[model samples]
Target: MTERTDRTVLLRGGNVYSPADPFATAMLVEGAHIAWVGSDGAAEAYAATADEVVDLNGALVTPAFVDAHAHATSAGLALTGLDLTGCPSLADALDRIAGAARTADGVLIGHGWDETGWPEGRPPTLAELDTAAGGAAAYLSRTDVHSALATTALRTLADGLAAQPGFDPDGPLSQDAHHAVRRAALAHLTAAQRRAAQQATLARAAELGIGALHECAGPAISSEEDLTELLALAAEGTGPEVFGYWGELGAVDTALRLGAVGAGGDLFADGALGSHTACLHAPYEDAGHTGAAYLTAAQIADHVAACTEAGLQAGFHAIGDAAVDAVVEGVRAAADRVGLPAVRALRHRVEHAEALDEESIAAFAELGLTASVQPAFDAAWGGPDGMYVQRLGAKRAAALNPYAALLRAGVPLAFGSDAPVTPLDPWGTVRAAAFHRTPEHRISVRAAFTAHTRGGWRALGRDADGVLVPGAVASYAVWAVEELVVQAPDSRVAGWSTDPRSGTPGLPDLTPGNPLPACLRTVVRGRTVHLA
Candidate 1:
């Protein structure tokens, strides 16, 4: 976490990957911007003038990743506290929680437990959580963060929980009930603990080659004080650049006051699919009830109008078809009120536009909306027989995360991990989109990579960044790879051969079984944020 002081550096013998010149072999970093890029010989000439010269030994260098949607404080907590992402069964999850609770002195907080893959096909009940916590207050969030199970002690601490929607006193809580408990549970962490957790998450992101993170904060997700503190921490230059988005309805003043990039990010139109709260047009295959909808079309249109008039970016968290319909209708109405050109100029975004019909896709393109999608959602719950199929049946499931369709319709695609729901694996996210379970829905590896990189920067209105070129931001990552191959849509093996004439740089072999490239270093503004 040391601040890099070297003002000038020459990176030689590396394959520089950029859209303009994908095959360049060297780059010169002067202060906070890329000064030059060309051959190794050209870099060598300026070596004497540089403050430092580092040989890359033929490593692949590209723009560092920018995660468009993330919950900074929650991600940090999950990193430092008990993580049950790998627990195979409900029994194992409870056992791990019990172990953590035995040693933990205060409120026990844990995350990332998914029962969809478990044999039980159900989460631990409230009684089970109580047994695990041994009377201590505990709140364990499901992998999707849409729902959570709380011990009786914790529920007692949460005010008016029984009166809230999605309340089940002895079972999992969703919607407002979940939000209430989450807020109470997060209150247990002291300021120091929260700061340490945030640092830990950002450090991990740097190691994974991430240069920036968009913190999706809200009244329901995290307090204004927490968001203020996180923004202050990022301003100190200790971690990646943090773009704050306060998702509260009619909170433009709050956003501007806190120096937020937007007033909407994870401003829920609905919940997530895994929690059976994604506001589907039809009832879930597994459950009788259709999902919940937090915002009506009128409400969405109103918020968009307010944000647009105030010159702020407006967005929503919409996953299911019904929610998508609502969002599209809202955007259409906003366009009517503010004019299509004005609405499009704002470049409003929709987080997790996972389930969309042809009509919705057209609406996104016509309105010039940015789709901030998470490919890992498809990787985790997609496929022929994955959790999505179990909940939605075969016909509806196959339509999940239609990346190819979205791209073809001209919707701007920005990729992210939605971390703590899925770990922040940028490479894995690219692979998942390329090798999507529905073959016709898959995109090329290069296209997927661009969405994660350049598309993400564009989402935050950083058009000049997320690309490696002269005069661009000098934020990039170096990786050591075993082999290089460009992935083709039809066949993985067919793309193994290098083709310089293809006008594309060789990317890491990211077939399902191939190992991802090991990140050697991550540089932000010509400063080393992580070095291995």
Candidate 2:
């Protein structure tokens, strides 16, 4: 950990947005906490006692972001390795893969390939992947990270993947088959490579103004050794504070033993929508089949009850309506077993609550379940003619990612990027929520900003760290902004100007055409992690 010293630092000439004093223009940091916050003129008095002073040069300062859900090692690999996220078509993706294979030292692992916007509207086949790989093993995960395309060499490395439930020898693998192949692919990486990848991802997070991250690891996603290594790295205090969550069902002891904050996160209730595996009540429009459900209500109830009794947060990856229903039923049953108060006090969470109905929304609010969601998912695929409409048709697709409805129903919302699925862009995530495809579902800019900052802390059961105030932890970011405007809740695009004399803090102008602020510096616990 970065050693906290008894040094007083003064920051002046910047706009400080704090919950306690919304219009402060300067702040004094005494050790690892805020000592004073007030006007720039008044801050001059602190210079006599300050060991260091920084002039912000009219920048904007706010609380640093916390990503509630992420995959650190995989995201790092994508950052340092071949990335297929920008491939324009199937042919382009193949050419890139073949080129990567020709130069790779060993197995080639890549991520972020989405066929949704492709003109061909389809993914490359296993045969195509094999040809691209030449003689090497390769595994490329789709944008959702729920499915992957692997070469024959990689498949052969997994002993029984060919016979797994979701396996297709000639097509992309989902569920068990994908998990098996992924484990083999990950095993090929050396410990040095893993550490380098992890460091790269953390450096990127700091650049994007993220102060903390919740790493969702599991038996299927990553090994226990990987989680231990990552937690140890966090202890070094060189990067973001990483909170680990092991998503193994009924493994509360293992999670506690490994120093994980939760027993469940990305504990798959079903697969993803793009892969045609997300368990749904009704059949998909294009596939003509109801998606797969990995766990039943009874299984969910058992896990929830056990985790709650153990005083650990329990969560699941539920995207489809059927999976959401199963989660609600399980929570109800767990509440019955343990008292409702006990269950609610645990602050259990649900990841990607995408297909919720009225009842599920109410149930989540009543159970005090935090919705760890990704607004970037909606931004990428939630428009009228986006991939979601192609998958579920118009009506069913329109209901995805109802942020406004969830907020109105009293469900606590925390936002993240789900990196490697979507890039780690906090400003983009906030803009996506504010400018939701369905206008009725769009939230105010302030609400979206708060969700990405304060809500993320609450999701990890750290409610006291996301604000800038006296007695609060000194973690924040400085930004270069083009304009400052406080968006009005009643207007869609207008009514955004603010008067400085009113003493109300103004947020960055996030209207569609306005440029988002660029991060200049990120500080965590009085230590500088990133500086431009």
Candidate 3:
């Protein structure tokens, strides 16, 4: 599985998106580092000496993307197992489950079922699920992964599961009850099955021009053994780089032992809005009570201070406004206790920071926290008639995922799909952020693209990677694009033209209806991992 990177390669006759030479049409890769980026005429000097020369044939070359937040095993399972992502109705979903159960050897695990849009306006009842699976053990996670429907057979696997909070004998499981059942269901997978699932996810990532992935694993979300195996597989040099984040309170030693870059990610401050579990200051419009709060500000402070002292990044999954407030409060307290500079230097993260306000945005910039956000959430659930409005009403819903405001307030952004909840489609992610339904919340395509690429590297304290420049890692993708142009949120700023004199590197035209670029090849550390 070892990939060779000893040869020098010259790539010429294409648009190169490199800040080092904005108008460059060629690049040189010497071993695992970028050596040069300049005009086509300048590339001739290296062409004679390079071990390999590739004719770009009017394509585009840019830094490969980094998915800042992901769950490998879950994504893989969704890819290989029964997926209910777009099931038209509860009956259709149940039919799919019934079909899966006839051939499923063990637990009939399935994911990505959303009941909001169903004509029934509800998830399958416990009896309905049992009937669908023919009374066999089954677990079907909701699209948001915050809640799930578990058959009686599956619930039996976890002793006293009914006693756990968020458990409902006749409805979907959430919180502790959901976590317990998910673990039991995952345990049914054989080691070989798990490995295959992880590999499948990685292969898909590479194919989509992804150079790296940040795996959000925890005791509640995934097992230590699962994270270890995934890291080992990635180390074999056959796929995108995997950076692990172990989400648990005071788990520094465990994180380091498991080769994790941080002790946080899915370290839940709260749940998600789709399940009506995201901690809100006010009660949900549909539900009578405020959503759940998994951690207090004090608890958050303790975790952040400990992680900062241990030299590990600390992050939390805070999707509700109240949850975001708690994170901001706790991180600020940690800065007070550990010295602001030390805490800020770690560049800690907050996963799925979908809810924010002016204060939280300012706090994030002050604390140097990376908002590991997923634009697909807004794309999927934010609008006049979407789930956010259903849960929080129009005014509050309009405030969710304010990327433009965040950027204005200086909060760093690292984009991801939070896959299994959203699919891993990098260009689609950028497009979603650029064309947000709330027009005021939209950002430039270039900014969104950078957040998916270099911003991810910056989040991990790898300042120089995720870009194409001299001395940077040669991790980039070759794309077959119809055209390249500079895009800005404001036409005046971009000059509304494709002029080389602008000195701004162009990306594929990402207009709403335009086709996305097709990946022709993907290279990581100067080694080709994918080719079309």
Runs with alpha carbons beyond 4 Å of true place in candidate 1: 1-6, 489-494
lDDT string for model 2 (388-446, tens) is: 89789899899999899899998889998888899899999999999899887889888
* Deviating ranges (above 4 Å) for candidate 2: 1-4, 491-493, 501-503
What TM-score number comes out for model 1?
A: 0.98
- What TM-score, over all chains together, does every model reach? 0.98, 0.98, 0.98
RMSD of each: 1.4, 1.4, 1.4
**Residue-level lDDT tens digits of model 1 in 1-532:** 6655558889999898976676788999888899888889777799999888889998999999989898877898899898999789989998999999999867888899999888888888777889988999988899999999899988988999999999997889999999999999989889998888788878989999998898999999988888888889877765578889999988889999989999889899999988999999999999998899999999999989888899899999999999999999998998899888888988899999999889999999999899999999888888887899999999999988889999989999999888888988899999999888888788888899899999988998778999988899888999998766765545423456577777678888788898898899998877788899
Instruction: Estimate the lDDT of model 2.
Output: 0.89
Task: State the number of backbone clashes in model 1.
Answer: 0
Model 3: CA > 4 A from native = 489-496
Candidate 2 TM-score, true structure as reference:
0.98
Among these predictions, the greatest lDDT belongs to 3
lDDT value for model 3:
0.92
Clashing pairs for model 1 are none
Q: What's the lDDT for residue 227 in model 2?
A: 92
